[model samples]
Target: MTNTAPSLVLPEISSARLTGLLEFLQSAEQLKDTLRSGTTANGRPESTAEHSWRLALMVVLFEPELKDIDLLKLLKLALVHDLGEAISGDVPAPLQTPGDNRQERERRDFLTLCEPLPADIAEELLSLWDEYAAAVTAEARIAKAFDKLETMLQHVLMPRQEASFYAFNLGYGVDRTDCSPLTRQIRDKVDGLTRALMEDAGRESA
Candidate 1:
């Protein structure tokens, strides 16, 4: 009788590969210390890790309004969107200068960080990061919208005195045309909130 037993397929992961992955993870931990321009509810500056975590949650919270999207892909995009910032550090949009090589620098840093992983894993990560950076794909566009939305929300939530920088930030280019319906709605809401805050600040100063 011919043997009908299925052959066992062991995973190809090696100890050295795992060690490399671990090193990459350890390096990623630095993101927690990378401060962003936005502040927390308590007025402390926020970190890239905090921003990414909140952005991931925002994906789930806004999923209902973003129909037909691949939620898992969006989630992954949110998590890895700023992983490059782990090495490049957080640079506020308003502070970025024209002809700046920040994107190229971040891309190189991202590649270096991914180098420690297996080829397949590294390729997947690089692909995701590139997609998010390109912002051409539907998922990428939505992710970019959420990133701006989160920043706007943070600005609105922060104390008025501490958030004066937002006046300039609000005027910064935020194109809603490419965003999902839900993202557009949120953008409108953020606009309204920003206007109200500005008005309040004006009244208080007067």
Candidate 2:
């Protein structure tokens, strides 16, 4: 006698859900057009997408220094940290003032971006953004450190005028007194890189 087995059926994804996800993905592509302060090796303005990509890589490269942190969560945080720029455009550091509401604006923009996604995914993305912005968790703090380090590294590597160089130094000089050991290490590296760049500039001027 032959035995018949029941076939398992999976629920079909809703067309509305798929459409919303697709729309969100298309919206994220606009991040490539969000210009940041940093320039490429060829002197082109860098995009927020490029910054986010390198930041995630920086997190992995500095993993040995990070202690008791979730690498996966840190990576996710790095990627979404600037997703708000997709909607709000990149706000360069030097342009911000003491009373600027840029952070609040970015948070609102990020929420708007997530509004098209499924409820659970939207919640997760919003939470990740908030956590990074708050810097309350170890992962969030590490992500923040990597973000700053990446920006400083770009300034060190890129060619800049005296005014731009001074602006970069003033904006990005990380104070390590209150930072975690891993963050402090990254900050020291940035300081050394900046010093070397300044010496090179001095030589070229001479």
Please name the candidate that would achieve the greatest TM-score relative to the true structure: 1
lDDT: worst 10-residue window of model 2: 170-179
Error of 1 at 204 (Å): 1.8
lDDT of each: 0.84, 0.81
Error of 2 at 138 (Å): 0.6
Provide the lowest-lDDT 10-residue window in model 1.
172-181
**Runs with alpha carbons beyond 4 Å of true place in candidate 1:** 1-12, 162-164, 176-178
**Which residue segments of model 2 deviate by more than 4 Å?**
1-12, 163-167, 170-173, 176-178
What lDDT does model 2 reach?
0.81
Clashes found in each candidate (C-alpha, N, C closer than 3 A): 0, 0
Among these predicted structures, which one has the highest lDDT?
A: 1
Model 2, range 176-206, lDDT digits (tens) per residue?
2136776776677677777777766666777
Cα distance off (Å), candidate 1, residue 125: 0.5
Which whole-number lDDT from 0 to 100 does residue 54 have in model 2? Answer: 97
